[model samples]
Target: MTLLDFDSDRLAEFATQVRGDYEELKAKNLKLDLTRGKPSSEQLDVGEALLALPGEGDHKDADGADVRNYGNLKGIRDIRELWADVLGINPEYLVAGDASSLNIMFDLVSWSYAFGNNDSERAWKDEEKVRWICPVPGYDRHFTISEHFGFEMVSVPMLDDGPDLAAIRELVQDPQVKGMWAVPTFGNPTGITFSEEVCRELASMETAAPDFRIVWDNAYAVHTLTDEFPPIHDVVAFAEEAGNPNRFWAMSSTSKITLAGAGVSFFNSSKANLDWYLATAGVRGIGPNKVNQLAHARYFGDAEGVRAVMRKHAGSLAPKFTRVQEIMRERLGEYEVARWTEPEGGYFISLDVIDGTASRVVELAKEAGIALTGAGSSFPLKDDPNNRNIRLAPSLPPVEELEVAMDGVATCVLLAAVEKLGA
Candidate 1:
């Protein structure tokens, strides 16, 4: 029966059984974490060759520039070409950066504040108030960058296909709404990829801020878990066609494909934005870690080589994601107490639990020694207005441990549902 259809007696019986299961889980003293979408140790092993690259006096780049020296402000040309191929952007528009794309993103925001973009009226810090459109249930780190800079974050709804363009079109009418954070492909925690229609509209939309930016964080561009990967529309091509070439900042990294701590990061956009970024970033440092960039270029060898590495990642990761879905289906499918996304490529499964019970479920899971991403973390200020969505990161755990942790999570969901139903 549906949860709402359960009679008082039936609800009471279900609650009692769930309470018993909860106690048993507590007794086991199990410890499992589904907190972060970290690559498994097996996944890390796939990129081991990156460590041995550029070995024994092999320090010159393709153009014979000594990589050990520091002069290529836009990074070495060969590595830039490799990433350009991997990211499907023109080599001239893209620049290689250090390991963390998050750092690159932070730097972009900081630069925008210190010195406005190529077309801005003034530095963002000089504005009376700055606002940024943030899609809901997004990467917390993305929200963190805007929040840290004191941008008034406007939460936008994330539809199954993409962020609500109708709403975004309207929000951009205000000049102070300078930019928005977007993960166009396999978005964090939600796995929603923007469709071609959405991409075209985003590129062509009218915005009051000439410097309006779309921080297109394509973090999982090639991190597919299945053969039928979702098609990612080219934002750069679309934006250029719309005569808004400077409207988007495309970012990506090999953090998941290779070593998370040591992989390369990239930023691609219009020449104006690229020139502006280079002018400011040049003042900060000479160049990024070229030795590491050289190693990555050789490690991947070419675009096809990068695909091979990602395929190996899929082999190890796909099953863990599948197992999580199967358990959730078997245990909670009939209860109708929750719903979740079965993503094709991303590292997360966005779970929306019974309203008003998500916090209780999280509390119960913690008591049973199973850690989950805290409720409402997907929203700005770490507040989910409905208090319903919970991000489930299944990539970190092995299948067996995931099964155990998921069982405890299932029990907590049931117990919380029953309590909320007043059984």
Candidate 2:
């Protein structure tokens, strides 16, 4: 059969059998991992200069602020400008800080519970029970922070259109609901960006709680796996116009940009939110790692620097991502038995196995020396109500190994799908 067999039943069947053979082979091969959305070692090379850091060459900001001091707690000056440009928010609204943006998120929640923002005089902990809406197939760490704080967690459904807005609107009308975890760009696990309508609606929303906030985490703003990634600026501005300009607390970091652990994080919001965060966080420490923040600013002076670095990352990642999709299309595409996301920019592609077979597929992968992120990790408390979604993080594996490993995954999914259908 020709290579471009769009309708070649023979090629299709052959692909299916190849999957079975690979799974059989995997049952005998050495160990491997294709679960975490971590950048490969080769991918890490682009930001190597960041590791050496503020060498003797560079030393100050645009305003003569020293890079080696402890008082720039809000963040380094130029990088604040850089973060503003990078995150598409005003520089005044941004808080340049320590490396982990997620850490900042955790801290914000802690602050809200322990000490309410300036607008609200009461600590959230004094309330009967605070609540948070967690979009399903969401970041586990987001859910953990809520659970850690003893906040009631509500699981909101997510589809291609983003978190079901109708449910979100209704849920937020309750005064007890405090915030929602959002990754508007290239959302983790499911490469879903919110639809423009949903975003605008979220911004225009009148919540039940005056102190409510949107934990707007835009972690994968530039990592596009497909051409479908749209810049959702329309919806992002709702917080400002909705009268509660501080409604969205946005955070991003260069951790995934330059290096995972050592990169700097930017926190953006309205004037009120910034004043609130700074007032509480001001008591805790000096400034963030300005040295690293400045290093990133120097390494990537503008959008061009960020884009150039991302393109290099995409080059290293594309082949691996493409291979996984190709295998899935070849082996599981025809079955009507399983479905997977065709992601545009995020690190993960969520796979939905036959109704009751996800755990089995993961178990099969595990027995053969591959460790899938535990089956339910994409959900809160590692619980996927349907036990159907599996996240594929293709960036971490080499092409050759990924090809073989993905084939095995396809085989497991197919076997599980077919077995259930037969029963």
Candidate 3:
């Protein structure tokens, strides 16, 4: 039976017993964590060559621009070319920034509140209280940004395929609704990609707020754990075809590809949007570190180089990811009471348990010394309506320990679900 069927007084009674059992079993396991989506230090080693790239002989680019200099506020030209190619947008349409695309995301949101986009009128904050639609079981960080700024976060149901477009469409007419957060490539926590139809719908929005934007963060564009590298549906192109030049802002970084502390970040959009962002950014700083930009240009010689580096990341990360999958398969995949997303790539596996049990399950895991990303973190303001969504980050643990940690996590999931439903 599915997890829902076990929701009953009798099942809840039995589940309490199961938790009691798990509490006893847990004493045997010492400690582990399946939280936080950072590359294992070992997995991060794949980009070591980036530290010493572009020797003295490689300083000058084909455009006669000294990559080492810092005058270009829009990032080194070659850097834009590289990211533009990687992001699938024309070079002229993109304004590549330095590390931290989310910072760029923040700037855009802040700008919308302060200044309008595309020669539009009225500031976002000055307008009616802003509303944002967030796909539940989403990236917590994205939701946090909105909440910290006081944007009313409305939860749009996230399905196995993507966010429910019908729900999004129904609310687009609400004048207070201003934006949505999207991670198209491989969404954090859930790992679901937006369906082509949904992308088309969002791009073709007829909203009361003309300043509506889609914060497109493709953090895992190339870091797939799956064999096939599925391409994300391009919503920007759809928006243009739908005649909304400023519909979405595309972002990415080499934080994963090259190095985290120092990596190139980028943004892509229509010309009008680029001009607005550049104007706003001119006040923030003169330029991002050019040396890092040059290093990326040299480290990733071309588009093919980006892919090659990603393939290496996949090779290193896959083994770690597999350990969690194998453990889930062994412990819960056949039980029918718990289910997890089997992503082709991306750093997370989203787990859903009996409604209202997620937070409790996390507590159980923690009592035994396993740290999980807080329950409801995948939802807006960390509010999972059903409290069933849990994000599993398996990329950090060593392979052998990851196996045990996942087993412990599954035990907690089953225990929590059973307890909640009296299973």
* Inter-residue clash pairs, candidate 1: none
- Could you give the candidate ranking by lDDT, starting with the highest? 1, 3, 2
Q: Which candidate has the top score in TM-score?
A: 1
Q: Which stretches of candidate 3 lie over 4 Å from their true place?
A: 1-29, 56-58, 421-423
Question: Pairing residues by index, what is the TM-score of model 1?
Answer: 0.98
The digit string of per-residue lDDT tens for model 3 on 333-423 reads 7556667888878889988877788898899889878889888898877777788888999887888888777777888887875655545
**Candidate 3 TM-score versus the reference:** 0.92
RMSD in Å for candidate 2, one decimal? 4.2
Please tell me which model should have the higher TM-score, number 2 or number 3.
3
Each model's Cα RMSD: 1.1, 4.2, 2.7
Better of 1 and 2 by TM-score: 1
TM-score against native, each model = 0.98, 0.91, 0.92
Q: Model 1: per-residue lDDT, tens digit, 157-246?
A: 999889988899899999999999999899998888888888899999989999999999999998899865556566888899999989
